[model samples]
Target chain A: MPDSNTNVIEIRNLTKSYGKNRGVIDVSLEIKEGDIFGFIGPNGAGKSTTIRSMLGFLKIDSGSISILGMDSVKDHTEILKHVGYMPSEAWFYGDMRVSEVIKYAADVRGLDCSEEARKLCERLKVDTHKKIKELSLGNRKKVSIVCAMQHKPKLFIFDEPTGGLDPLMQKRFFELINEYVAEGATCLLSTHVLSEVNKYCKNAAIMREGRLTMLDSPKIDDETFLSFYDDEG
Target chain B: MKTILTKELKLNLKNFLIWSLVVGGMGFVCILLYQSMETEMADMADAFSNMGAFSDAFGMSTLSIASLKGFFATEVGTVHGLGSAMFASILAIGILSKEEEQHSAEFLLSLPVSRKKVITAKGLCVLIMLVAFTAICTLLYCLAFLIMGEGIEASLFIAYMLRVLLMNIEIAGICFSVSAFSGKNRMGTGIGIALMFYVFDLMGRVVPDLKDYLFIGPFSFANASEIMSEIEPKDSSFIVGIILTVLGVATAYWIYDKRDISS
Candidate 1:
């Protein structure tokens, strides 16, 4: 477990909703520096909503989120400078080549990611010359991975990061996460895949219907953990 | 902001080219028709005057198509105005909603940039594209005039083009605000707003009672014939256009700042 004194992300009663639809309610979490935190939830369980709210993407109805000791809403632009995010569904300009897409990401973050991006692409075995539209799902996922990692942000937020990766690539991705954690970076991995949380995360939070139902060390097996969904229904 | 601007420009370059060609082509065809119809100018004028309902709807009641400038103002200018307004509407509506429509909002909004900056950058890109489209249309108009060996007063022509540009920006601002507040229905709402404004302007011209409400629609401010004439430009229309644009943009910014991004 990471030292409790060095919390990288602090959420207090975060609530965001769409009209009457439930998004997330009274969600609060604390992720310490260098901790591999897993956010486990089924489809439409508000995992993305919570992460997006923390990242200042969605406006909250009530509550507060602070990252790196700065308020997420008030200091959004500054906070983003130190964060790397991988969304659940990867998308890019369809007409752009893979290299151009990566370069564009680097440009947006004001970083010269050429060397690191090239190395990451090589390691991920992603083709740099293919148009974004022509890349397969897994390949596009690889591009997103490279883009997210190239900046070497202090905090990494991954939403369903392994959806399109093969088993081999998924293993390699976990290894990369471990490497980053070893370097004192915090990671929030949101996924419904219980096996991923059990194998990699030290602490996991389970969400159902836009509320956190569990937050503890991963002690149950994958099948048992998934049975929580059935029990709730 | 710079990065977003560059990306927007890159993505919409093809769209800009296509819209320019369509608008410019309409101008070209109109100018060519003027040459073929020159000999029958008197008859054409009489026919348009007799078609009272049609003239009122098109704002051609007082226009004499016998002259090249009058024909260009009433026919070519109206088409160009409508086309440019549509293009602006599409650009504004697509600016923010396309991300959600394509399910890429997650990827974009996750970046370090704030939501306000994102909107500002995209809005700037839309404005720049509208300016470019207007400039291209103006150049095409000038080319047609030169080919037909007709020289219009340079200042009047410029004033007319400036009005067109302002009108387009006004429509874009309204549509952009609509997009910010709406979700999947943004495009439909934007186009509908433009169409409604157009219909309102037509009604204002056709119905004497509604003429007093001409300030409600943007088309009322964009009078091509008045612009081409030597009379001083109407400051009331300009003021109204400016107010609507400011209000629209301010509303957009405020709503987007508070709105939730639905999954």
Candidate 2:
């Protein structure tokens, strides 16, 4: 990890739940600028919940999240201005063309991201003319990538971004991410993929049952992390 | 906010057109049939007047069904009232809930726009839709009158349509509030809210004991025959209904701001 004390994201005792369902509990995390921090966990291990709670999509029951040194709740919109978030699933309006969806994303940010979006779409071979419903899962992920990265935000949060991508596309996705990270940006990559964390992330946090069980470096092996979840009911 | 508003308008345009056509087209057809049913309605009007609660419930007692205006009020009135209410409710209910239903809430909320701005944008979409629906249906009704060579009271017709618009806004606001609280499309709940309010008005008119409390429901202000006879019918229901509409929208903004969007 690059030596940087400037925290891009800081979470302290974040707690969120959906009615009777279990959500992240007392989760705390911090990542400095220019760090590719991996958030690894099995399905339903609160990885998404933590990321979403940090993004202010879900109201936290307790604790606080500071993004780019701004409160996630109070300054949610301001935080979003400089952040690019790619959710675990990429589902858009079915009736809209891929081009329209990208336009909509760009329009919301009030930016003409056409140049970046065009290059990304060309690189990913995205059929901008096709309706979103007609696109494959991999293509949808590509569209998500374009929407997220076109603006070139200072911070990037990708949740299970490569699940539906082909091996080549997945490699490309990481490559593009590396280029951005090289530009003094910070990233929080959440996924269940151990290889991605090992090969790409500088550091990681293993979450289990709504809590961060451990925070370690690239040397943290998959066998130990996988065993932690396999041992539980 | 402008971006989302335009997007919502574009997305919801198809459904709006469909609803406007179905409801207004039905009303237009009803007006066309009035001339053919003239003799039948004249006989039925006298018989209906003696039917007590049934006639009163439908406002056939106060307004004679012998004339086109009266017939339109008694027949097409019910159709438009029910149809427009359903349309408005459905539009409002789906405004926010569909984002969650399609699992696009994360994509939408991830933007720099705040929850309040999202609600406001969607609320404005609902308002613009309600207005367009009213204008389209009103134009169709006017066209029908012109086609039939019938002379409808312009002031009374305007008043009736305005009440219907107000009623639609009330229903839409309440359903929009439900939309904010819901994680997915609550079509049934939205329809039920509209139907419940209507049943209350119908029962209030039929049951003498409930008549005084008629102002509690939106239909009380929108009874076509009431507007037909007394163009400026004294009903405090619109005030109550409008206030509730404001409260409903406010509640939507409040709840959506705090509610946890499920993954």
Candidate 3:
């Protein structure tokens, strides 16, 4: 772990609930600058809930979340300016062309991402001229990836970013993320795929049923981790 | 906000155009029919004057069917008012919920903009579209009167149109507030609210005792036929409408800011 002073994200007793069921319960974790933190969880494991609360997308029941030393709820707009987010499902205005969607995203962030977007599109083999509705799921994911990374934000929050990509594309996605981390950027990658986490992450947090069950290193073998997960179940 | 507004306007351009054309076309056809029926309107008015229950039920009690404005108010205006209310409610309901329904809320809320800014921008877009639809319909009304070799008093025309516009805005405000509170069921909730208000208005007209409580429905305050015939609008209903609108929009902003976005 990095020093406490360099913590990019600090969560203290974060709690959220949907009706009577708990969405997240007293979940707290810290990530320092430049750390590749993996948030591993199965479906309904509260991974998305935690990330969304951090991003100010969902109103939490109680506790605090600070990003880049700024209160997540009070300074959400300012905090988001320095962060890049890619959601699991890539959905956009179906009527717009891929290029228009990217341009709109860039415009919203007040950035000129044309060049970077073009390069990413070329690398990912995405067709910019095609309408978003016509693109395959994998291609739409590529568009979302380009939109997220084009701005080169200080922090990246990716939720199941490689769900629709092929093996080759997934490799390239990891390469892009690794390069970003090498530039002293922090990443919070939420996914259930343990192989990718083993290959890319230095630290990992596993969640189960709205609780953080394990927070450790990915140095443990896949079989051992799966066995531990099974024993918990 | 500008980015979101532009995208929203572009997405709903087709919808706005369709609603405007439908209302305008109906008005135009009614005006043309009025030109041919002008000779018989005196007799028609005499016949309708005795049907108190029917006239009150349809809000044709005060309008003189012999005049072009009165006839338009009684027939075309009533239909257009209902249509406008439905259209405005749908627009308000769809503004925010479409993102969630399409599974695009995650991508949108993740942007650098605040939730307040997003909702404000969406509200602005809906307002602009409603104003555009009203303008188009007003221009068509003017053109239709001109073609029939008749003209409406400028002040009267403005007053009538303003009443319609205000009613639409009030309906939109209530529906938008409901939409903000609802999740995926926003459209249904909005429609239900609109239907409830309309039913209340109709019941108030049919029952004498409930007439005093007409302030509860937006339709009671801005009846086109009443406005066209009267010199001044009823102040109590006007004040009630303004209050409802302000309360609705303010409540929407408050709830949307605090609500959890589960999708």
| Cα lDDT of model 2 by residue, B1-263, tens digit | 99999999999999999999999999999999998999998888899877889888887888889888888898889999999999989999989989999988999999899998999999999999999999999999999999999957899889889889999999999999999999889999889999999999999988889988989889888999888878454457878897889999999999999898865
Ranking by DockQ: 2, 3, 1
What DockQ does each prediction reach against the true complex? Answer: 0.68, 0.87, 0.78
Query: Residue B135 error for model 3, in Å?
Result: 0.5
Count clashing residue pairs in model 2: 0
Tens-digit per-residue lDDT, B132-251, candidate 1: 998898899888888888856888778877878888899999888887886664767777777787788778777889977787677776767666655454567678889999998888
Error of 3 at A92 (Å): 1.9
In terms of docking quality, model 2 is high
- Candidate 2 per-residue lDDT, tens place, A1-233, comes to 43478999899998888788888889988899999988887788899898888888888899989999999988999999899999988988999899999999989999999999999888887899999999888899999999899898889999999988999999988988898899877899998788898899988888888988556475567677677578462
Per-residue lDDT for A150-201 in model 3, tens only? 8888899999999989999999998998888888788999987888888999
Each candidate's TM vs. the true structure?
Answer: 0.94, 0.97, 0.95
Output the chain A TM-score of model 3: 0.94
Worst 10 residues of 3 chain B by lDDT: B225-234
Colliding pairs, model 1: none
Query: Which is the winner by TM-score between candidate 1 and candidate 2?
Result: 2
Cα RMSD for candidates in order:
2.1, 1.7, 2.1
Colliding residue pairs in candidate 2: none
RMSD of 3: 2.1
